[model samples]
Structure formats: structure tokens, C-alpha cells
Target: MQVTGFVPRETADLRGRAGGPLTLRYGPRAVVVVGGLPGSGKSTLLRRWDAPATLIDPRTTRLACQARMPAALPYPAYRPAVRLLHLLRTRAAFRRPGPLLVHDCGSRWWMRRALAHWARRSGRELHVVLLAVRPAEALAGQRARARTAAPRTFRLHVRRTARLLAGIERRGRAAFPGARSVLLADAVSRGRLAGVRFDAPR
Candidate 1:
């Protein structure tokens, strides 16, 4: 999404709350909102961590595994309501006490605010990670990955990804302010984040 201006540097220190692992003492009840263009490794990172997390990915919830949201609903008509319901359900599910809730979505501003509000009311911490890979690099990577799949599937994914990335670039920071945008190189090299940190209530 060509994230320019005020590129953040690596985090100097990331000690846990009480000088320990950044484990949630209140409970494993927290949320990690991950946002980025397709092929930016958002899913990869979540898979790599493999933490006991409740993921709220629309593609997964809609078309892949469970039909949390009906597939028949047109995108524009059903998206907002479905997403709201998903967030609500996910939050309520964690209310009884469970692992961290990781929402692997676009990480748009509205989504971030909703999650942050939920966290505060539920007394959970919110962590945001933005996977800011260059558009060209991401597109190339996506295309390469798609080649392994069926032609029809690959074409659909590529087209959808292009649209999503374009939306993010057009929206800019207004799309996701709580997120810390990091280039692929920086994320890989430093293994840390640099960008303005947004407190939960922001």
C-alpha cells in the first residue's frame, strides 16, 4: 500500500508487563489485530505463532471452513453486518475466558476501534501488527504462490487481492492508525516494529 511518511524503527525494548514474557496475566484474553496487503504474510505469521488464538478471517469464516457468514450475501450488502457479528461473537466467546483472539483482517481503522473498545470493556489488551510489504513485491509473491493452485482459483485470488491492496493504499493511514506499518525488509531484519503506537482508547 505504499505506506510512506514517518517509517518506524525497530522497537528498542519489548519487556513483558511484569518483567516476564508478554503473557496476559488477566487471562490469555487479548486480541492481536493484523492488517496488511495480501501476500504480506499476515496468515503466515499467525500460522507460525500457532498460539491458541481465535482467528477472525472473513475468507476462512465465510468460504473455507465454517459459513459464519452466508456465502450468498453480496459483498457490499453483507460484509459490514457480518463483520460486526463476527467481532461480537468472537468477543463473547472469549468473555468466558480463553486464549488470545487474533483478528487477521484488513486492520482498517473502524475494525481497530471496534476491537479496542471490546478489549477495554472486557479488560483485555490489544496488540496491532501491520505487514507493510511493497505492492509490486507482494503482487509478485502472490502471483507466484497462486501458480500452485488451480487456474480459476488463482485468478480469483489475484483479482481480489489487487482490489484490497488498492483500497488500503487509497485510504492511507486513515485506514488503520493503530497499526504500525513495517516494510518486509524491516520486519525480517529487525524482528521488531517501528511506528507510532496507539493506545487502546485512541
Candidate 2:
């Protein structure tokens, strides 16, 4: 059997958040959810994790969909298809026998609930790693990546993400229902993380 692993000091990051090179040992039977505002470097964090787990990233699904669609087709034209496809893929990914990594913008309650349900049914802990960055910094990240959300959409993400961050700070674990715990990581701390390790806690 596997169990979540974190020393008392590390628990502060899991609850309070960031500091040094992170070595999270949440177990291979974990559903690690990485969330943040649009362009908040959720993707970067996942990419840096460099784990061998099944990664359920909507951006990857979107790019796959775009590759098959006509070059003239805009993303909005097939956004629903991409969402459905990504959802299906995520559902399928959970069936595998190891840690599952996913990225989100932190505004979708239904999605998080569904993920939590799946994790519980599979006897896995649902761990959330939320990237908390300033809205200006997030937008700058968006620019750095050369792929930005629509202005209105970004503004909405900012408001929702801000509210979510606040709730986590004020209410702690209560803010994220069903999640075993949450890690609030800033850019500097997250940047220092070498990678994630999932295995039986010793």
C-alpha cells in the first residue's frame, strides 16, 4: 500500500506553501492536480515535474485536435470537441496504474469534483498544487509563451483564481473540497523544484 509523505516542515508548503527545492512524495496512487489562473505557469510546473506519469493536459489535446483539423479552422470553432475529447482522455487516463497528472485553471468546480470522485473511487489521493502568481505576472507569462487567452477570458480567470487563492488562504483545506491537501507555490519556489517523486512512502 502507498501513503502520502511529507515531513512536518513540508506540510507547511502543502498547507501554507513555498520555500526550497520541493520533493513531494504523494505516492504513485495519487491524482496530482496542478491549477492556477490562465498563464500562471501551471503547464511549466507540470513540464518541469518531468515524471513518467500519464499527463492529462487540455493544451496537448487541443494541439492534437488542431493538427487534424483544417489549418483555416480557429480553436473557438472546435472548442467543444476539444473539451469533450480532453474529458474522455482524462477519464481513460485514470484507469492506468500509476500517478496521474493534470492541469487546470482552478475555476471549474465541476471538473475538480469529478477528478476528486475518480481519485477516491480508485483508492488514490487527490492532491492539488496551485500556482499562485500575481495577475500581472501571469499575463506576462502568457506573453512569454506567445499564446494568450482572450482579454475577457483572462480577466475572468484572474477574478476567479484570485477568489480561489483567497479562499485557500482564509479557509485552508476547506477551500478545495475532496482534495487531500493543497500546495500553494509561487514562481520562485516552484522554479526551484527539480521534479516530483511518486512512490510508496517510507
TM-score per model over all chains: 0.53, 0.88
Which candidate number would show the highest TM-score if scored against the true structure? 2
Per-residue accuracy of model 1 over 84-167 as CA lDDT, tens digit each: 666666667546565453545443445566666667777765554555555555556567667233456445545654554455
The residue ranges of model 2 lying beyond 4 angstroms of the native Cα positions read 1-19, 200-202
Q: Cα RMSD (Å) per model?
A: 10.0, 4.1
Kindly provide the TM-score of model 2 when superposed on the true structure, using C-alpha atoms: 0.88
Tens-place lDDT per residue, model 2, 72-184, is 98879999999999998988888889888888776777887788777777778787888787788888999999988899998888888877877777877567777777877
**Candidate 2 lDDT trough over 10 residues, lowest sum:** 2-11
For candidate 2, give the lDDT of residue 64: 90
